[model samples]
Target chain A: MGEVIVITSGKGGVGKTTSTANIGTGLAMLGKKVALIDTDIGLRNLDVVMGLENRIVYNLVDVVENNCRIKQALIKDKRYPNLYLLPSAQTKDKSAVTPEQMKKLTGELRNEFDYILLDCPAGIEQGFKNAIAGADRALVVTTPEVSAVRDADRIIGLLEANEIRRTHLIVNRLRADMVKEGNMMSSDDVVEILAIDLIGIVPDDEHIVISTNNGEPLTGSDCQAGQAYMNICKRVLGEEVPYLDLEVTKTFFQKFAAIFKR
Target chain B: MGFLSNWFKSSESSSDIAKNRLKVAITSDRAICSPELMEQMKNDIIKVISKYVDIDTDGLDIKVTRTELDDDSGTVNAVLASIPIRATKPLRR
Candidate 1:
């Protein structure tokens, strides 16, 4: 059987879709069959992020509603043969898919894939419930902001209440410079406050914006954020990869060069 | 004098402030007791305690708070209620 993991954040705009797209792609690159399910119906963007929006003829609602078979709705990524995306319906609302339907759908997907990732919507509403219904584990994504961490705590509580005990915390957009200057919380601080196992921390990288705009995941790229996503993927696959050291070390030549400007 | 006083001043960083606030907020959130439920619990406590003694219901304060665990590891949610007794009921013969 395959593992079903849900990527969730109580607050929006915390890079849930971006993380899902990159991690799914990374897993597929590792020769694992991966299926990313966009459960954020009516606000579907996973298809766009995966650069397969135009190829979507059927969606999650269609498959669940029996309008199309699971194979018909699954969009194979042209970039990776093993990566598939089940897009959510743009016209349908969260109420369109029940939790039971989601459980059944993920159960069916588990038979054919090694990993099934559900990109959950923001807030603890119907969308959140449906996304986590069939999930064997959860990845709670948050930033260093106070509001984001607060919402992550609430999401962790809800996940525990729902018996999803295999939850891990991923701190994204951590500014190493700010953390060194004591202007932003470090990953250690976030882990201590959340009291969960730390999965991976993705540093603030401008390349993420460029890749998102181009509809390409930054997993296999050479960017810092791409390396971070690849590390997260290895960790997800049960590899003991050490955390990335995000500290900025100025070389002696750069330090010598700065003396002339001062 | 400026540098000397600046050194003595205790200035908390922004991240420290964020961590402190999140710790306090998350403690209450994990308690899982809504305000409505707390009020209901207070009423129930009054009903049970009023039979043995007269409590100053208006002065009663009840809240959910985190109490340190006995093993000194962490904290757990505990209901701390402060009820003032007006008078004790006389015992029946």
Candidate 2:
């Protein structure tokens, strides 16, 4: 059976949908059959991010409500033969789906896919509950900002309380220059605060905006953020990959001074 | 220069400040102890202590904090209260 993982953050605009899109594509790139489910009903964006919006004739609500079969709702990504997306309903609200319905839908998906990635909505509401209903693990995404970290902590606590014991932290949009200047929190700082194992650290980059705008995920891209997403995918498959170095380059004199400081 | 002065200043970076604030916020979030609840708790503690001994209610201090476990296991929320004692009341049989 496939492992179901939910990418969630309690706050909005913390890169949950983007991470979901990238990780699902990365897993498919690894030749694993992957299904990406967007559970953010009434506010669907995963389809747009995955570049499958125009092709989504059916959504998650349709499959769960028996309006359509699961396979019919699944939109196969043309870029990756193994990748598919199950979009969310833009017209229906979150209450249209329940935890039990989501659980059943994922259970059916597990039979055919190697990985099922759920892109959860922001906030700990019914939508969040539906998204996590069938999840075996969780990736708590957060930015380096204080508000994002705080919400991530809350989400982690909720996941633990709900008995989803396997949780990992993904610190997104980290600015290396700001971290070097002591102006922003580092991924290490976020991991320490959240007290969860760090899965990946994606640096802030304009490449991500470009990719999202182009409706293409960072796949086999050499940019730092792109490589970071691929690294996260490798780690998800139980491969040990060193984290990307996001440190600002130090001058020789600064390196010498650092040796003395140590 | 401001940059030079900042380099010489204490390690009170904004990130450090953010970390400190997050520590406090997460601890409180875990405890789910609000300010009003904390105030009520303090008053109740004061009321209970007042019956046993002469405590200065005005000097009472209470806060919800997190402390690391002794066995290096994990941290837990703790309620720390500091109450000033004036004079103990004699026990009456």
Candidate 3:
């Protein structure tokens, strides 16, 4: 049985799409047959982020509406032979498909792949409910901000209420420099407050934005943030990796200062 | 009034910012208390606690500071706030 993983966040603009793209790519790069399903219907973006937008002739809505077979809707990526994406319908709304339909959809795709990564839409509305129905486990995405953390807490509570027990946390958009300056919240602060197992921490990077423009994820880059995301994927596969401290990557002076601390 | 005299006489709004916003949020997140509710609680605690012992209602503080909040499962340290309640004069009957 394949693992259906929903990458969800209670608040919007916290990088759920970004996390999905990179982590899906990471898993596929690891040689696991992966299928990334975009559930953010009507506002589909995973295709664009995965740089597979032009190749999407059929979408999830098309599959559900019987306009095309699931094979035609699945887009293969050039980067990874095993990785595939089921793009969401840009023309239809979240209500275009029901949770039962989504569950059925994922159920069909399960046998063909080892992992099904669902890029869940933001908020706890119908879209949110639809995104989570078929998932065996959930990855709750949150940033180190007050509002995001608050929403994540609410989302965690909802997941608990729904009996989805194996929820994990992925803290994105961490500005280590700002954290050092006490201007931004640290990863420790977020983990302590959320009280959930930490899966990964993605530092804010210009590389991510640059890669997003090119429809590439940072996991392919040599940046620290990229390594962090890759390690996250490894951890997801049951590997033991130490957490990355994404502090304003210390300079020699700063490192020396720390070494000489009284 | 001198500068020092006016310094202590600033409006409560300015002082409000000095307090942490986390308390207000945690109270709501925990879905238990509110500032208005805390004020009401302060009044009740003063009224009840003053039955036997004297309390500086104005100086009497009830803080929900960062401390451990106990539960059935285990104890987790939570907000330990200081709520200051000043006692008022008795009715002139």
Against the true structure, candidate 2 reaches a TM-score of 0.83
RMSD of model 2, in Å?
5.9
RMSD of each: 6.7, 5.9, 7.9
Please report, as a residue range, the 10-residue window in candidate 1 chain A with the lowest summed lDDT. A157-166
Q: Model 1 — interface RMS deviation?
A: 3.5
DockQ values per model:
0.41, 0.49, 0.08
Per-candidate TM-scores read: 0.81, 0.83, 0.77
Q: Which parts of model 2 have CA positions greater than 4 angstroms off?
A: A250-262, B8-10, B36-93
**Lowest lDDT block of 10, candidate 2 chain A:** A157-166
Residues A109-136, candidate 3: write the lDDT tens digits.
9999999999999899989888889988
Residue A150, model 3: Cα distance from true site in angstroms:
1.3
lDDT score at residue A148, model 2, on the 0-100 scale: 98
Which whole-number lDDT from 0 to 100 does residue A49 have in model 1?
90
DockQ of 3: 0.08
Candidate 1 lDDT by residue in tens digits, A122-157: 999999999999999999999999899989988887
Docking class of 2: medium
